[model samples]
Target: MIARIAMLFVAAAPLALAACATPAGEYPSLAQREIERVGMVMTPPQTTPAPPPNPTEPVLSQARELVESVRTAHAAFLASESAVRSRVAAARGATAGSDAWALAEVALAGLSTQRSRAMVALADLDRLFIAASTSGESTETIGEARSEAADMVAAEDAVLSELSAQLAS
Candidate 1:
């Protein structure tokens, strides 16, 4: 009985030691290994810094220029409409289908064509303003651009109303 007990104790001792031993290639202490790994990971990377963002002034300037162009086109339309009105007024006392009346009619047709072209220009400017608003522009800059666009549109509406009144008269 004593020999069998001694044999069992010898067998269990080797199994217990094997269970407690660290695996091959593994660190002896888990906490120390984790601390060392975290220290390594905490070091900053060795890459160059990024460049600064581009300036927005140029974008704003371009938007302003586009607004000016729309204003100019609107002014031209107003001038052309005024010219048509003047021609019509001059032909008022003349006979229908007379040379002066015919001339006035031709001038009015030309004004229509000019007005169509100006409208196309204004539409393009509107597109530019929308693009400026959506292109990652600063909010303040976009607000200024929007305000300018609104003022221009109001001016355009006033001019159109005046033109309508002239035609009605």
Candidate 2:
């Protein structure tokens, strides 16, 4: 038993000593200096490159799209209203506010407001576009573009109101 214990002690001694030293204690002053030197050299990032904005080459302005979509929907609602009217004409005492009628009402009313707001926004955008164009181009070209935009805006408004009254009825 005594011989076996002595052999075990010899084997464990080298392993215990090898495990005792850490990297920091290998060169204490140099390790601390190295850490401080690195800390001094380190910095938070300074420059942040911005992400690319959405491409606007193909699509119209957001306002223009909104107005156009609403206008399109308004036309569809008018057609539906006319169909409903014809159906009621065929059958007397035909009720109002059926599911289809309600859907038409909601769409027409909600989209009317949206179209109006969008039309206003589109007007502002057109003004801005015109101003920007004028800085580089001729007055005649700007005038033509402005007139086209005005006509589109007028058409949207007219259709929206007509559909709105149908919804109310």
Best by TM-score: 1
Per-residue alpha-carbon lDDT of model 1 for 1-169, expressed as tens digits?
A: 9999999999899999988987777756454565477556676689988996675776667666766665676567667776777877777767768887777778766756555554554565556556656876565654565566566566655655554444434
Where does candidate 1 stray beyond 4 Å? 1-55, 91-102, 109-121, 139-169
Clashes of 1: 0
Top candidate on lDDT is: 1
- Please, what is the TM-score per model? 0.44, 0.34
Q: Which ten residues in a row have the lowest lDDT in candidate 1?
A: 160-169
**Candidate 1 similarity to native, TM-score:** 0.44
lDDT of 2 at 148: 57
Q: Give the clash count for each candidate.
A: 0, 0
Worst 10 contiguous positions by lDDT, candidate 2: 86-95
